[model samples]
Target: MKVITKILLCFFFTTIFFSVHIKAIEEEQSIIIEVEGDPHKHRQYIEDYHPLIEVVQVYDTIFTGIALKGKASNLERMGSLHFVKKSYPVRTYQTNINRSVPFLTETDDIDTEQMKFTGKGVKVGVIDTGVDYSHPDLSANYKGGYDLVDLDDDPMETLPEQGEPTLHGTHVSGIIAASGNMKGIAPEADLYGYRALGPGGRGTSIQVIAAIEKAVKDGMDVINMSLGNTVNGPDWPTSIAVNHAVDRGVSIVIANGNSGPANWTVGSPATSPKAVSVGASTPPMKIPFLEDSFEDKRIELAPLAGSKPWDLEKEYPLIDGGLGEEELPNARGKVVIMERGIVPFSEKARKAAEAGANALIIYNNEEGILQGSLDDSQGPIDIPVAAVGKKDGQWLMDHVTEGEYWIDTTYQNIQDKIADFSSRGPVTTNWNIKPEIVAPGAAIVSTVPGGYRELQGTSMASPHVAGGLALVKQAHPDWKPEQLKGALLTTALPLKNGKGLYNPIDQGMGRMQPQAAIDTETIIYNPMLAFGKIDKLKDSQTVDVKIENVSKETKTYHFELPQNTHGLSWQLPKSFTLEPGDKKNVSIQLSVISNMMDKGLHQGWITLKAKDTSYQLPYLFINREADYPKAMGLEFALKTFSKEEYEYRIYLPEEAKSVTIDLYDPHSLVFQKTLVTLEDTEAGVIEGTLKKRNITENGEFIANVEVKTTEDKTYNYQTVLSIE
Candidate 1:
């Protein structure tokens, strides 16, 4: 009888110990709590919770919230508090810069030197990985700023000793207002750096929001954010902060993102309605293409950064290099073709170069063409590297297997073409057309930490517009933020793809034309018409467009009929005249016959004739429920305060009946196991935690997510997940 009692006591003690331990682990989660009243007043209340939640920071300017660390169960309980409005999981953001000035200025037609619009007396803030204000070109224009990471006034770029050093913000600032030997678009604009992202160019959404509020408090006329995350929702926290900043009279510019060449890839901050999101376009350059020996096939090559340029004129034998993660088959004096996965692009290039390969081509594992860069940390790769689409790579691989295949290079003098890396979008939920405009982003030479360096991305494209807005602001100090944004969009030059002009989602109004924007007298607000999703067979939508005559003379406007489509019809306003300084709002209606038209996204341009020039306003609408990705922005990582637990977050476009994430070996592509499975997941961000004991292994994995929507539709998405 004593032995039985001892056994029961031992069992009870073990159960109690584990319950307390689990509770301790669960209390380490961090989230941002938005409250109904002032966040400062509610801090004590949050800290006094049963589990003892810690208030990290209180925000009152741009966002009324408090960042706190506590148990998820307590977080839900706090949500029930009358003062608590909502809560958001802290999401991380990463740095996402330069350009030829003459290409955008149209110097031949309008001499900027003669015009003397140098953006003097305008304050422009760059919120990125901080800046090297000591650079010779940027020193004179460098104004004081703050560092959110360190909570100080010294907003310098991350140093080597501090962590991973960064030059991204310096490059972006130079593009806006470099005052030395290399002149930027607006050389005289006052430049300030907000160090939101710290070491390794990484920062959380809270830091970003804090930086925006700081910039606004400093009374910055314009702000540029070259950093973004993979969340596509328009209502994300950072995006909402952007809208609020714009409402406060600050002109905000954001990089559309680099996850592109595919539709619906534009991420947060860029998805903000009031922000001017910029995309990438190439300046005048020689683009390389590979042709087969028989001249039967040709494929475009997007050269990777930090590698030798593709200048091979002679035909070279092509050999498949698998994933380039392992040993290569005799590739001496030949071109190596590798698939993109497992290892970094720089690692693959290093292996190929060691194998005496003349060149390297890494193809995408997914549908679209790959736009990649070699890691600078791995050192320079001697051989030239380029990327191609999966289909083209597979074709080359098939030909290589059949027999020996040789390829020769040809060059196309391409300019104003959309860079494949520039993210595209008709933002989810709101279905708004993003990337309000494109700018020169490819091979832009600007200021780095030490000297000048050439970098490329939508990051470089954003500063060009920011600088242009500065010039506009200097030229018309009376104009509001909306007018400045509208001026750029209405005057942009439309860009063309292989089929025709690139869609609004791809290129927006088109590449930025600063000279035209400065000289234009008419500005059209809400130029890109997004009719959203049409579910009914006979659906009609009306959009309000505001037109302002900024020119000195009276101007008359009339809309030309759009191309005749079977199921689409339009109602345009009658010809109307607006005198100088006059503004009017006009309603344009679109009627859709869904049964007669094809289902999916439909977009085109509507012409509006104003005086001698004709303006093309982009229009977009979906016939029925469009087939956008069901899941995206999947992220998994170990908890910051608890190593024994792992957390994950994913964005779902619609309510899903079930969501499953399957893990696969990066190299072998074999199924490992189901990493996560959930039922009845709602739309928006779904976040959860898993015990470390549940995982079989910890390493890098290729996560293939299958989401079944409540409507019985299934969609798949692929991403890389790493755990330690």
Candidate 2:
């Protein structure tokens, strides 16, 4: 989300072979990479390589003079040369790459028509802070809990904050098993609350693992984890624990991180194959309305009768138009009228006094009055500063038109309008596609310890999906975690956001449609077959294939592969055949160069490719494991997102002719490696576009954009992308 910039953000690559003609201009000084190999020695060139910038050319290979990152330093290797195979390179886009927030809504939307109709007698578990055991809506569903964080067997005691009260866990528990009047997805399911994080929303990896262990031991049908760390590397302990948990029948739903940047790759348990990840979506929004009351503490303690009069002493002057007149003309030591805006309530009061106004009355920009100020707290403003709902503001506007007084030195709001700062997606950084099957979030009226809390976040969205999974599991107690996850993925419905539509990269197989997944009657296969060589032809450039089923049921399907127009060129047949539980590998072979096309994102999914198709088996995302710094750029002008777009230009110094740019998603290469044309510019200002793409897979994708100066000097830059 767009956090205040002041907070140090804890928000937490490819080849192509092309010739270049650089008419050397002047001496250059940049890191140079010179590859020397026998020009005529084909296979030898691919196998042997070295970085020769300052060292003498010792190898028996041609010095394809220093590629300042791959551009031509000298204009010579211009005319195209023919050969059997050539290494492909990646295309480059602007360093401003896209990202996705991979998550699920745990639904059965696509084929809701066929799902088994029944509420299985199954209970689920929410391994979080704790649950609100006594609320009208969720009270009947609150089964029980344990405090994993405090190491307590009692789920009720989350922390000392409640003097034997806990909030986080209770809320989570309610989401999962809270049944009766107000319903949860698995209304029949019981709950085992494991408070991992304390009341402050803080917890370690150890605590989370502990919660998982407890849930598994307690026979929890489903476990939901809605929190995560920004740093995700190979050595995360949560991963190890969840992998073990998966071995058992217990299913898990983990939340993808909310912190953006460094493309907060899926952390710990969420990255685990069996852990179903739930990403956040924008909270439902409606125009703000003027109100007189709400459920928050601030609104509860409103003045019943006559309260203290507005104190004018501490009022400070606001900018040019303080509450006085030249302004208002008739108003003096009276209450001032202000629009709901940036300044704090205290500041507004101070400003009114500075202008000789006694009281402060502010209204929201929308139709009615707002319940409370998102920034309102106690103490700053000396004079009384009160707000009215949006409707009141409209009335004030209407009053002014009628030549009547418009000041109401009072604050009133009934229902609280949801705050808009709540983060939305297609997740901007991680690959979270949209529209995430939105469950309740934003001022959601849910159960709490003393009473209830109107909380919001992906955290809320997570438990809803978790609760739904409980129902799915209850229905198919025999299904494996993979089966459950596949159902969620395969039966998802794709949605559109500001950035086009959600893709696998961003939304991860689309938003979970529980009912659809539950009702699906057929299988849609997108298998990654390990096809062995079939034909041995003399220098054959192509090969054929077939399919066999190794499943318990007989099946027929169609196949499709990603477009391979680059170096590694190949395609598959449209149709294939299979039988019950048979071993069948499609036959396909090719004699292509290793570096075929540009390095970036590439996919190959096999599906029914037909109308009324069913059963889709998704292969994993294209991103591979790679290591990079876990921390960088925390202290910068990083806002949630900028409505204002920007442009950038990288000019190649005259000494450099062509430039090669590579985009990466973390250490993994993303889009096609692009080598842009930068010649004929006396003043350097190359153009680049930040185009958005729609994909539908789940994984953290990054692009490493590099530039090579004509003199062989190279520079590398990495950035995050989002195209759900």
Q: Compare the candidates by TM-score and give the number of the best one.
A: 1
Question: Per-residue lDDT for 430-479 in model 2, tens only?
Answer: 22232223333333434556544444454665676776676567666777
TM-score of each candidate? Answer: 0.82, 0.50
Candidate 2 is scored at a TM of: 0.50
What local lDDT score does residue 220 receive in model 1, on the 0 to 100 scale?
97
Query: Which regions of candidate 2 deviate over 4 angstroms?
Result: 1-119, 157-166, 260-262, 282-444, 498-500, 523-554, 561-574, 578-611, 614-724
Give the alpha-carbon lDDT of every model: 0.83, 0.42
Worst 10 residues of 1 by lDDT: 12-21
- Model 1, residue 508: C-alpha shift (Å): 0.8
Stretches > 4 Å off in candidate 1: 1-58, 65-87, 97-99, 110-115, 313-367, 375-383, 390-406, 634-650, 655-724
What lDDT does model 2 reach?
0.42
Q: Report each candidate's C-alpha RMSD, comma-separated, in the order given.
A: 8.8, 20.2
> Model 1 clash pairs?
97-460
